[model samples]
Target chain A: MLDTYKKYFRFLVKYRGMFVLFVLMLTVLGVINAINPYFYKLFVEALPEKNYQTILNILILYVGVNLLETGIDVIVYLLGDAVILRAARDVRERVFKKIQDLDFAYHMTNSSGSLISVLKRGDLAYFGMFHELNGLYRILVHLILMLVMFGAINGQIAWLMGASFVISAIASKYLLAYNLTTRKAFNKQEDNVSAVIVDNLINYETVKYFGKEVKEQRRLSKAFVLWIKTLWGFANSFRLIDIVIGLISAAGLWVVLHRTFTLYMSDVIQFSDFILILGFVTSF
Target chain B: MLDTYKKYFRFLVKYRGMFVLFVLMLTVLGVINAINPYFYKLFVEALPEKNYQTILNILILYVGVNLLETGIDVIVYLLGDAVILRAARDVRERVFKKIQDLDFAYHMTNSSGSLISVLKRGDLAYFGMFHELNGLYRILVHLILMLVMFGAINGQIAWLMGASFVISAIASKYLLAYNLTTRKAFNKQEDNVSAVIVDNLINYETVKYFGKEVKEQRRLSKAFVLWIKTLWGFANSFRLIDIVIGLISAAGLWVVLHRTFTLYMSDVIQFSDFILILGFVTSF
Candidate 1:
């Protein structure tokens, strides 16, 4: 993995400034998000004081902060697009140039259909990797920050939240692994379906001469049957992941909120604290 | 659009039972979601009564309701996949067969690369259309249900939410139209990029005979340049939509919450009502 990243790093190094700025913006966004629940705590706590203008001021500031977050998000996306797309373009061009540099014998040995599929899938995979990595980074930052916030208020609740996170992360890991396996199978079938169609199209002359149009059509139909089956398998894996994650989140929310509500009832914490914790968990 | 859906309705009619069940589940889900904020109201309102048992019961029921929602979501996804994928398979097979039935002269006139692109994109477009339409349906259901709940509490707030929805919808219509235009341009450039590569691959022998590998490489390089430009244009359009929609949502949220909070301060509404409305808007 390190070796693979090292290779990708070369492409990104050219856009180092923009990439750095993008990461900075993402980190800023994550921090802003982690701190957001505190604002609700502030708002709710202010209400009991019955100072309308002060409350309104807090509300305005809160909205302003949210607006700022949106602005940062826009900037992050623009920077990400500028950096990732350019680097990907460079990588693609390099790959294209290298392919052309291959000897005649290599070209004769390989089917161009599969080659095109590999290249297309590779380009998309690059973008996917970058996008998912950024998502993971943001989630990590938010989770850690939230855990710290939770710990500051109540250690037991923090531990509960932490345990749930660990469990959910582990569950996601295994579930996503399973999902990836199904996805690979689906992708292979999809490629096969396209390859069949493309080959038929490319070999139109051969099919016409042999009068094998019906044969090719039957072949594509068979491919579609498998395609449909694998597609469902892939889709079903997503449902499985959602069900598992949803269950975990619900269980976590129930436990944490129950504890927080009990604390509030007993005067162990204020109502705003309860609301803050609720905001944090639900937003998660 | 009605005629287009009429054609799709034929495919869906085969799984009419599942389709009905899916729609019913969606409605139930939407109703459950709209009422969810009221649970927070109940929880908060019950606090002063010092009714631990009652509160716990409400909490349990709340979690149970959420679990039920998750269950329905899973069923909806499964049913949707079963129905849509199967129907789409039939449509794809019919299109494939129809393409084969086209005369030899038609086949001779059209390039296979573009035809293959059409078939592939069309299959995806069918899936996309179904997926997006279902999403729009869910949003519509959820919005209307939410508005009804809001109206029951305060007509002015309902009007506020309704107006925000209208404005957002109109903005989305225009913004998405812009997005679609950019997307089409991107798709055209993407197809051009791939067509160049596929054509070169398919005519490898011709290129090899002419020793035009360098020229082919340069052609692909030029195509990537345009592809990058159009892809950025497409990506930027999404940012534009997010900024506009985010601004509208924040403004609407600020106004509604400000009104609700002022009412709570003046004792025109209970603390629970404020919390409930806050839950509704934030959840949106």
Candidate 2:
């Protein structure tokens, strides 16, 4: 099953050109996203300096960069879908067809909700995984640029920022994984509700013959109550992740800023450079 | 269904005493967690000044706070279980007893995995929700303290930080909701699979009588193929969340840090004071 990743990739191999182009577009978009903030610094520096020509140039470049980013992003978005949708649909088709060939007993033992969740998420998951890989690649580009900028300002600060980002990223991964366990537990219960409703529906004749309509209702309601609870569990895990990320981001923000703050105080960097560094890092 | 929240709270009414105590413990724990980092700032400040006595005092208080935190956490852990288990068991007992009075058809209609999953997560969900609420409360408290400290350092910086956190939290909420919609779609497929399997099992005799064993196997296999796809969706959504958080956190981290960087450059803050602010914000 783990190797299914390879299978998915192979299935998507035909879209490799699109995927590559998507990556290239994302890189360009990222460069633009990072650089756009520089306008703030440039505008500020020029405002007091009364450098009309500089401001005009900055305005033109800002518009130019935005246009470029928008164009690249549009293509990246389309190519992402092309790569993911085509592969996912292909995989789904193959698997579902295989299921059509399966026996009844196999369907009986397998849970419908679980199966559907697996199937429905297939294409999106493939798409998401590809998108995530591309996103990470863009972030890497952002990160490297950030590091280089920090290093330019102060090597010590760059080292600290790099360490902080890496360490936080790793730690957050483990934390997110832990939360995943709880999410899975909730998902299992959700599948159960599907199973119960399904099993009940399949035995409609038996239920009717036994005159157990009221009882079936009670059973279904009971499952629903539990389903609601598990649903909340699933929802709350996202909130926890949000909180965790908030804390981690705060930590990372603190580490890098504090270093730069110290450097600024020591007169290592001027106010303009500080603004530039600040703008650049924020681009990340 | 919305009343379910009221019902859960009403069910937990008996544990009100425990809940209040839990909050108190958490508030204390939150305070300790927030203040613990200040020891470093204190130590750093005192070190440069050769204030050995202050450093010793900070160390002693640090250890003492940690010890207090640990002790409180243990009790909180116990109270958490007591509160959640009592509520969940009460609910389960009520539901299961109802199942006992149900007709045989009712029992037959319900799938075991679905039933067990509901029962298993009931207690945990109850626990997780309560934990999440408590955590959010603690975060709120931490956030207030952070904002206050920032205000103390520089009101403008504090405002920007608060704004960044709020804006990002809101943005992330919408982003997550979009992902949840996709997640729910996969959940639907999972339910279908559960239904397929459970329905087949209930009509086991029908399949046997028809000598349609091969067909039954095919049917089940068909359901499984769908299940695999949904599983991928579920997996991919989590990955998407990871990527989104990575990007959003970067954005938030950037806004706040950049502001502080400018503050330092303008001589609004000293190097030591800068470190202190950095240490404090990270506690959030």
Model number with the top TM-score: 1
- What does the lDDT read for residue B242 in candidate 2? 52
Residue-pair clash count for candidate 2? 45
* Docking quality class, candidate 1: medium
Clashing pairs in 1: none
Which window of ten consecutive residues has the lowest lDDT sum in model 1 chain A?
Answer: A110-119
TM-score of 2: 0.52
lDDT of 1 by residue, A124-146 (tens): 77888898889999989999988
TM-scores for the candidates? 0.92, 0.52
B253 Cα displacement, candidate 2 (Å)? 23
DockQ for each candidate? 0.59, 0.05
lDDT of 1 at A249: 83
**Tens digit of lDDT per residue, candidate 2, span A178-272?**
67777677667656655564454445557667877678767666766766666556555555555555556556655665555556556786554
Q: lDDT of each structure?
A: 0.82, 0.61
Error of 2 at B176 (Å): 19
Candidate 2 Cα errors over 4 Å, as ranges? A1-8, A101-105, A111-113, A121-124, A201-213, A224-245, A280-284, B1-284
Error of 2 at B172 (Å): 20
Considering only chain B, what TM-score does candidate 2 achieve? Answer: 0.81
Q: lDDT per residue, candidate 1, B132-226, as tens digits?
A: 88878878887888788778777877898899889999999899889989999988887887777778778877887888988998888888888
